[model samples]
Target: MSDGGDEGDDAESDDASAGTTHALRPLRTDLAPVVEAVEATGADAFVAVGDRFDDDLRYLTRFSGPDRPYALVVVPDGASGDDRENGADVGRAVCCAPALFDEQARREFVAGARARGDGEDDDPGDGEDPGDETNAHDGVAREVRTENVGDHAGERAAAAVAELVDGSDTDHTLLVPSSVPHDAAVYLERAGNELSSTDAVTAARARKTDAELDRLRRAQRATAAGMARAETVLADGEAGEDEAGRPVLRWEGAPLTTERLRREVNAALAARGVRDAGNTVIGAGPSAADLHYVGDEPVRPGETVLLDISPRGPDGYYGDMTRTFVVDGDGGWERRAYVAVESARETALAEVEPGVPAKTVHGEAAAELAAYGFDPNAGEGETGFTHGTGHGVGVSLHESPSLTGAGELRPGHVVTVEPGVYGPDVGGVRLEDLVVVTDDGYEILAEYPFGIVPEKRG
Candidate 1:
């Protein structure tokens, strides 16, 4: 939906990470345009009468309270809590706080919220302690009127929205987002069939806020340490079994293994209050060649390994990065390919800027790859490097404002710049980093040393 085109790559993602946001954190400046756009779209006071599990939910309403796994409403303040069966802007958002997203599942959820003895006394600030894990001055968790309210996610949400819509005395329209699951849509319809779909929510998340960027940067810096630690594990020597007989990676026998290293990185990030969900991208030999490969095969001497580490930043901000290294020593065509990737990567980076289109950057990288001895476009039995130059990185590993194929670059965007040369014959070599786009230029979020000189191949 953004002006950016698809890069010749496949980096699909879903909003699965559980994130927490702090209050008094500058309200997202980007969200304003979206709310304005929503109002302009002829919708009455905008109703994100759906679930809260994706980036849009986090971006629009700051609904990062304890995980409820259900549907919600992004109703703006000054809205009424009454129903608008005919659709009204009563200036309040009514939400059913269910735990699931099924249709029949959510109706019961709304019934539960209505059945509560303190139903009239509900408030978002009940048990929430924003100072705990949230960063906002007006914490979303602290604003909870219904925590763990029901079993059906979207149904509960629709019931709450329907009630608000009916109660409101002003004529208003209800809006839903494309991110809402179809099942949830059915639930909203069942409630009264009054839900309308729109792209406002996702469009708002496409661009990020300053406070979000700050947290993303910090999370990325922590990821750098994790990446360095993974490389450091390989830097020690061949990965083998330890005295305990576990297949551990030994950095001078201090104790290292794919699993152990994974725990270490998570431990490192957790110490900084950043919880993680996935394993570090430490793949060895052929496995490393595959993008996003998460296996943990031990690294043997004289083999190339890829280390792509993406860790969560404070709240829900995510940091993504990639670096390739050889175990024992560097040699053969591997080193040459790494140099090629680094060149292609920089070539792309050089073209990145506010006014410049994203296409130029990908084109430059592709051109550099073609100019190199490696084949940028190979087919069938013989192919080298088949992926995009980069993509957007934020709440999710891949978000918006991509850097692939062809697309216009915009300010306030954060994207990755990774280029690679992969093939069955030559394995793979790639380097990636997170960058923030400014009005004139961009800044790299993840910092690492490029072009490592191997003393010898193990």
Candidate 2:
């Protein structure tokens, strides 16, 4: 966990506005690595198109535009005569945004690139400076430019892609991500461009930069606040009866339910400048065993309530965490499952280091669960460890370098180490923590207590 200091202070300060607060650190998105990967594919240009839901496109361009298609095109630096004369090794990055989003895109993508001096010159152009409009030919891209295309985002983006590789004498081959929209692919192909799919962007996103790590840490802390709010409510709750005179946990003069707890958690998250993105999973009683449950079942005094909240921050980064809580407990199967899951979480986290195979982490967690008399390979509907150990978390809630994937852990990789045990008999127990693989080991983003009994926070 991060030591309480400037980082902690910055995370708690809600004074900064959305989007602007996280810009304190410049993004270290070097396109050099991407260029190398693209070159290996023998593609004349790379193009990606999507609306706001496209995390890969957002990572490539850093343009958080409205829910309409925008495009990012990358070509070899010297592919065009203009770039060759400029003497750039890195490729060119062009953002094709709708007219309504032109200025916003320029501010987010072009301005940031200029501030980082990723371009050829360091001078952040004054109105009169001729070099102010020059392309960034160094770090993130050889040059970053934006075009205010008309209404058709996909068509315009395709046209931009065609123009970017038009200089090639041979049939230009365009490399597109596997998730590219069918319409965009059709447009590119109809424009006489050959389309080939590549995973370069996904691979790049697996390893994050320092700025991303900072954003993730802030997000996780906010998530912890949300969890604390739910826990606080449960802690302060008192025994009561429901409409039918059944035992229930009541808070604020009402029976506590999953829906009520979820609202509390989401409100806390919003207060901290993050949105729940409708991913707040609060399951009580038998509903807890059904992962991703979002119903309004009453929470009782002795049943497990699984709280899996993965909220998205203002800067587009996600924070994922899961904790199970039981209010005044009898400590039956719930306690045993909690202990096993916690141990499995620790075992998985211990194996998170640079160069360790990602699958090894899952295997170790499974082994630990099995040692505790829980079968990791239990039948589909049977109780035991059900899901994989964890997954990579970033711009998208789920990304690459998965715990079950055949890739090795890298220093900059941020992933979730979650081990869960589910059973209909006593609900479900899950413990999850977000961690970043460091040079030698791993660092949990925030410090959150693990216990079946709810803990009150001041």
Winning model by TM-score: 2
lDDT of 2 by residue, 278-361 (tens): 999999988898878988999999999899999998569999999999887888889999989988887887788899999999
Write the residue-wise lDDT of candidate 1 on 156-208 in tens digits. Answer: 56555545445533334557766766776666566555556777655556566
Give the top-scoring candidate (lDDT). 2
Worst 10-residue lDDT window for candidate 2 reads 3-12
Q: What are the runs in model 2 whose C-alpha is more than 4 Å off? A: 1-23, 79-87, 115-154, 166-170
Q: lDDT per model, in order?
A: 0.57, 0.78
Which residue pairs of candidate 2 clash? 119-136, 136-142, 137-142
TM-score of each: 0.72, 0.89
All candidates: CA RMSD in angstroms? 10.0, 4.2
